[model samples]
Target: MRIIIAGAGDVGFHLAKLLAYEAHDINIIDMDDDRLQYISNHLDVHTTKGNSTSYRVLEEAQISKADLLIAVTESETTNISTSIIGKHLGAKKTIARVSNTEYIQRKDILDLKDIGIDEVISPESLAAKEIKRLLKESALTDTFDFEKGVLSLVGISIDEESELKDKTLVETAYLNPEYSFITVAILRGEETIIPHGDNKFMLNDHAYFICQPNGVERVLDLAGKQRESIKNLMILGGSKIGIQAARQLSKKYNIKLIEQDRDKCFELADTLPNTMIINGDGRDVELLKEEGIDDMDAFIAVTGNSETNMISSLVAKNHNVPKTISLVENMDYIHLSQNIGVDTMINKKLIAASFIFRYIRKGQVLNLTTIHGVDAEIVEFEVKEGSKILDAELRNLDFPQSALIGGVIRGGKGITARGNFMFEPKDRVVVLSKPECIRKVESYFK
Candidate 1:
């Protein structure tokens, strides 16, 4: 696909890198020469330095022949205008990134689709939704529901006390006699491992599993983690992401928000009637304890500064808080999730890029999800008639070594993919694949 990106910022660069890996023709446009130069130095995509809203610049980037145009230039107005104009310039599809929740929530009144933006995404809103989902299963490092709750992918760090720490998958078979879930992937320090029966999970390894509806708890047990229900919550910062999370999660949990700006605190108090707003520094350890950090079920740090968020979360962890989630703006900080002792580190731009990438691939995929901080993707493919996959059992398919069929949803029922299982036409097959071999994995489904 020939794609044109309207920004060379984090989100646009990430989307370009993902598309570039697939050997797509990608051209990035931005006003900053340094950003475009950095993108050109690292990625194989072409870069054009200019305002994307300008028709001449769009023409220079060859937008008329572009399959997709993405606008994520940090300015909401610029993104919307660029997408609209890009669509008029003959781009097949356009996606706009926005910071205002109003654009996403009031889409019907805005008519963004009619104006030529085929899709719109708000990173702040998406991050808030992710925080709510992560809190549902507070014990796990990450929890993602697929196909509405029929399938789940859970990640947990292997600790010193984890039952599966030293045992290989074959030896740990007794731990899951019912086969409710399958070990899909493992994230060691810098490598993403596609697990086999002989793969042994080491301490500190982040293990991922694909489970049935009731398999989440089983996976929790296998990891030696006790389930805990979240009630009291604490959030740092009054930024859009922090405020949005408090607004959404306040209905079920007691919320206390801290903001360094006193005026912002008062505004937050007025905006969120249910949440308590405090004017204090989140980096102050004494303030955190005074505000009852020990009793808090979860600590969320979404401060504007990534350093403050990480340090505040570390302080909460030192206080024995059950869960600590930090909003990391730097893409490089995501890999330090557990290594730095924080439970979860999220980058909204990374999440937004992955979401848009999935939407772009909707034609070839039933569903696709990129696990945060993991170098693999879980993709759902609908098996078509006359596909080679339907002719033989899974074990005989000679599947890519870097990929694994995690589960299959057949006739609306979720089933764990076993070695002897044969796929049927129209079945939704879920596969976990590394980037290096994802294209080969997609071939079998095609």
Candidate 2:
């Protein structure tokens, strides 16, 4: 596909990298000549150094023939203007990255899509929602639900007490005749393995499994993980993400927000009436303790500084907080965070990039999400007539060995498919696959 991405920031750059690896015709535009040069030198993409808002720059990037135009500059105004202008310039689809929470919540009042923007993505809000999900399921490192709550792809660190620990996949398969769930992937020290029969699960290894709804308790039971309910949450940042998270989850859980800046603390106090806003450094352990950190059910650190966020989250975990989540800007720290004990480390840029990547891919992909620190994706695609997926039963199809069909939604009901089950048109199927197998898996739905 011919794609033009405006802004060489983290989101745009990451999107370009993902698409370029798939052999797409990618063109990146940015005002910073240095960033454009950096991307051009490292990635196999055409870089255009100029203002993306200019008609001349869009024309120069061949936007008229572009299949997708993505505006992800830091400035919301620039992204909005670029998407609107790019759509008018003949881009097949346009997406704009926005920071304004209002644009997303009040979409009916001010429809950005009506003005030519096909989609509006909010990274901060996405990160916040991820943190909320992590808190709700504190035992699991990651959880992705498909077809509402019918099926889920859940990740858990293998504890020493787990029954499956030190057991090979073949042994476990015989031990449980019910076959309640499917073991999809395993993350060892630094490598992610698409497990087979001979693979033995080790202690401290991160394991991802696909199971039907209400299988969470069973999965946790087999993994020897005790479920914990989140009651009290302490938010360490008063940024947009912090405030938005507090706003969304405060209704169900007791929320306490701490901001280092006095002005930001007051702003949060005025904006969020239910949350308790305090002026204190998140790095200060004494301050956290004074605010009943030990008594809290969950602690979330989402400050701008990645290092501070990581350290503060570690401190909260050390303080015996049941769950700890950190917002890390640098995607590199995500893997390490899991090993060190943080429940989940979220990256907004990656979330937005994956959101846009799903749009560029052909087929009836209803939704797509990447697990934190994991190199795999949870893709939801609809079965349509003339699609190759409907020709035979799932097990008989030439499906990628590294990927598995997790669940299917038919007529608003969720079904865990067996080998003999055949897909019907309009059935929503969820597949879990590694990054390398995404294209191959997408081809089935095409």
Candidate 3:
């Protein structure tokens, strides 16, 4: 696919990296010469340093031949203008990143799609939704809903007291007996294991599994966690992400939001009717206690400073809050988020990148998700009669060791298959593999 990206920031760079791995013809446009040079040096993509909204720059990037154009520049106006021009200039599909939450929430009013933008994504809003989901569930470290929550992939961190710790995959399944969910990926340190029968889960490892609606609780139970309904949530910071999450979750959960700036607090109060906005420093532990942090079911920290967020989240945990979620913009902090006792750490840039990547792979991929901090992807592929995978049973195939067939979705049912399970035509096979092996695995299905 020939794709043109109009941004050289974190989200754009990440998207380029992901698409370049799939051997897509990519062209990136940005005004920053340093950023353009950085992207050019790092990625195997053509770079044009200029304003993407300008016709001459778009022409230089050859936007007319682009299969997809993603406008994710820092400015919302620039993104919208770039997408609109790119679509008019002949890009097949166009996506824009808008900063205003109103445009995304009131999509029926603005109708960006009518103006040539196929999709609009707000990283702040996307990250907010993720935080809301994490707080509501309060059991799993991460959750990805597929097919409108019919099928969910959840990640749970196994504690020292977990019942399934030190047990092999086959043994755990045998003990459970019902076989409700499929264990897809295990994150141990820096390694992600697509579990085999012999694969044993260790303490402090974060494991992800795919299951139906009723299986989420069962999976949590296996990891020694019980579902706790979140009633009250205390949020620190009045940043965009903080305000967005509080506004969305306030309708369902009792919310108390704190901001150091008096003006931002007033703005939040006006924006969020159901939420209580306080003008105070969120780093003050005394203020948190006074605001009833101890009685809160969940505490979310999304302040500008990472250290402040981490420390406040720790304080909330120390105050006996059942769940704590913090936002970490730094990619390096993702691994430590789970290990250091914070329930979940979210990055808006990464979430936006994942969402866009899934859209780009829509036709060939039934579904695709990347686990945070895990160097692997869980991709679902539909088997065709002409595909190499349909030639024989799984036992006869020389499948890559890095990839594992997690399950097969056939006839509206999920089945965990062994090496002897035959791959019939139209079977939707779910595979878990490192990013490096995705090409090898996709070739079999293609």
Candidate 4:
């Protein structure tokens, strides 16, 4: 596929990196020579230095022959204009990254698709929805539901007291006699392991399990955690993510939002009537103390500065907050969340990239989610008639070492994929695969 990306910023660069791995023909455009140079040096992509909205620049980049054009510049107007112009220039599909929630909320009323924009993505809104999901399942570091909660993939850190902490995968069968779940992947330090029966769980190892909706409590029990209801939340930063989270969660939880700018605080106060908005620096330890940080059940740091978010989340952890979620823009810093003390870390760019990738992938990929700080993806695929996967049991199949079948949803019910499990046509199979094995895994669905 030929893809032209406007902007060499974080979102654009990350998207280019992902597409490059798939061996797609990628062309990146930006005014900054340094960013373009960085992409040229680090990735196998064509870089053009110019204003992306310029017709001459689009023509120079050969946009007329492009299969897709993605506009993710910092400015919303630039993104919209670039997508509209690129679509008119013969691009088959166009996506624009936007910051305003109104664009997404009123997309039908505005008739944006009529003007040639195929899709519009808001990273802030995506991150806010992710925060809300995490809050609902506070015990798990990450949670993704498939087929309207028929199946779920959850990530949890093992503690010393966990039943499966020191036990091998085979030994844990007694914990789930009904075979309601399976341990699909393990993240130990920087390495990702597709586990087998003999693999032993170590303390602090982040384990991912695929299970049915009713099996969530069992998974939490084995992971040494109890489900707790969150009542109070303290959010740092009155940015787009913070404001959106406040708007989404204020009705269910008591929220106190802190912002450094007085004008922004006033704006938040006016917009979020149910939230308590304070005009103060989030990094002020004294101010946090006065705001009763210790009483907050959850602390979310989403400031513009990555370091500020990390530090504030750590401070909340120090104050014994049950959950601490930090918004780290840098993908490299995601690993620090688990290594340090933060409960969860979110990167909006990565979230948006994963969403777009699912849209691009061929076959019956119903959903796809990238694990935070891990080099793998959870893809839900629909089994087709006469596919190789339907020939034999999962353990007998010559599946790639970099991938494993996590679970299957059939007849409106979810079941953990076991050695004896046989694939049937029309079954929704969820597979967790490392980057190198994505193509190989996708072949079965074709």
Taking the tens digit of each residue's C-alpha lDDT, what string does model 1 give over 231-338?
A: 999999999999999999989999999999988887998899999999999999999999999999999999989889998899999999999999999776777755
For model 4, how does the per-residue alpha-carbon lDDT over 135-222 read when each residue is reduced to its tens digit? 9777888888998888899989888878988899989989998888888899888889999889999988889999887688899988
User: Clashing residue pairs in candidate 1, if any?
Assistant: none
What TM-score does candidate 1 reach?
0.96
Task: Give the C-alpha lDDT of model 1.
Answer: 0.89
What is candidate 3's CA lDDT for residue 268?
84
* List of clashing residue pairs for candidate 3: none
Global Cα lDDT for candidate 2: 0.86
* Candidate 4 Cα misplacement greater than 4 A, ranges: none
| Candidate 2: pairs in clash | none
Model 2 lDDT per residue over 152-251, tens place = 8888888888999999998887645665577878888668787778999998888988777656777898888788888899999998899889999989
Please report how far candidate 4 places residue 428 from its true position, in Å.
0.7
Q: After best superposition, candidate 3 residue 337: deviation in angstroms?
A: 2.4
Per-candidate TM-score against the hidden true structure:
0.96, 0.90, 0.90, 0.94
How would you encode candidate 3's per-residue C-alpha lDDT over 132-197 as one tens digit per residue? 777657777878776565567788988877888999987887755666677888888767787778
lDDT of each: 0.89, 0.86, 0.85, 0.89
Q: After superposition, how far is residue 344 of candidate 3 from its true place, in Å?
A: 0.9
Clashes of each: 0, 0, 0, 0
